[model samples]
Target: MFRLLVMRGFALLLLAAPAAGAVEEALPNESAAHLSTLGRKPDWSELDKYQATITHDEFVQLFRQIYATRGCNPDLIKVELDVARILTAAETQNYFVLHFAKGEADRRPVPRWWAVPGALPNEARTAGPLAGFHIALDPGHLGGTWAQMEERWFRIGDAPPVEEGNMTLQVARLLKPRLQSLGAKVSLVREKAEPVTPYRPSDFEEIARQLLLRTGVKDARENFDGPADPEKEQTIAWQRELLFYRNSEIRRRASVINHRLQPDLVLCLHFNAEPWGDPHHP
Candidate 1:
């Protein structure tokens, strides 16, 4: 069961979503190109480590089942007998080729920063069953004063509000020491009820306006300080806040886990909260 989790973690890292941020380096002559929402231009060199580590069939299965469920796009990606050609920059028509192994015998070991339990040295394993396992616990959202803004909170009549972020953090805190006792190194993406990103909603205002205008919103307002209006909810102000909390915060957390901590497994803890017809009764 533990080994399975580590493998799943490896797969998750491979299919990780495009992160939020400005492009680290601009493509020549296409510096002004519009990227995905808060998305950076991907570094194709990152795929180098995965070369020849996966079989052709395995690549197809992961792509069809996990990466792109709607089916492959020939324009964006093309699969051949032993290599997958992925378009890195559409404007430049640049492609990144990934070579696949012929079969299990032909496969190269996947190069990863983290080590599995069985791969660890004997001394490392002597600590405990979970020794050498690096686990990252990401308690979902930013709780506290920001919970209501992120919409992770709700209240019943006389009862205290149920905040999903706070609850997840509580669970992570309780689970941390228990996992440590098992000799696994545990790290928390969010150790408190605050945000992980240094950026705030105001910092995203310009980007939000640009997005709104590009999406054909004729009059994207400059600044917004009014009450929440359902009819006017798609304004720049609302969009900026959404980008800050959802995109920037998540990207920062991912950066910490991927680059700094390099955990073997990342457990994102969350709880579902469905609407109750009557808060008082439910």
Candidate 2:
């Protein structure tokens, strides 16, 4: 699933990053002061101290999601991407990378979009924004048999000692209980430990790239105008129909679940990564 092939040399570096997302709790002011004393440069010794955690792809996926909804400038988003890249890369060096740093938040890249004047996203700008909105909780995907989250520590650049499948179920155990306590209905995806399943895409990028390569459209990286004779509506019609069916499925699922459960909210939890983008620690 990853576009960039994995390398074996970076084991120590992966140590500094963690697998989980940032906590809901706020950081103390002094946390920022700690990272500064560490050199700002990215290297292997700077990375190995922490556990191997999030990947770049995970970070970028989220950035894209927020970008589409927030109308934030692309340039600003990229810096945070760079920061994650730098920090994680540094972890390949040493755990002291954590201690050497100071002025915590300052060490992190400042999001330019946050500074754009009077340009807050509608969600951010809203007061009591989600007061009446109900959400559904769906912990998506089945981990298939014995999703065991092993209790082990990972040094950077090393494979996870525990199985991810079990780890996910353990997480779901914690999550499902919490949401139900909050008066929210939870519809979790199957985590049964079985054979893996593949979801197909209707997007043209993969198909287009293959066709170009096969046809000797040498510069595969160059923007190849999509095939259109203004005559062939095949791809166009297929695109629209796929989109409609896909969107309808989403709504249909929501409606069916809500109708059955009379839910006030829908919450979908996704697990996994791709070659798409950088993973942010913050």
> Which has the greatest lDDT?
1
Residue range 1-282, candidate 1, lDDT tens digits: 322232233336544423323322221222134344565555567668778989889988877776666564476677999898776665677878999998999899876676766688888767877898989999999888988778787777778888888999999999999999989999999999999888788888777777777778868765555444653455877888888889778867877776677788899999874346685687
Model 2, 1-282: lDDT tens digits are: 011111111321232133222211221122121122111223445353331233345445544453233433332223343243322322243222222223333244422211232343455434333322334454443333312211111222365433444445566667776655544445543334332212122333344344444445544443213332342223433333232223323333433443343334445654442222233431
List the candidates' TM-scores in order: 0.82, 0.25
Scanning candidate 1 in windows of ten residues, the lowest lDDT window is: 23-32
Distance (Å) between predicted and true CA of 89, model 1? 2.2
Please list all clashing residue pairs in model 1, or write none if there are none. Answer: none
Residue 201, candidate 1: Cα error in Å is 0.4
Please list the residue runs of candidate 2 whose C-alpha ends up more than 4 Å from where it truly belongs after superposition: 1-135, 141-170, 182-252, 276-282
Score candidate 1 by TM-score against the native. Answer: 0.82
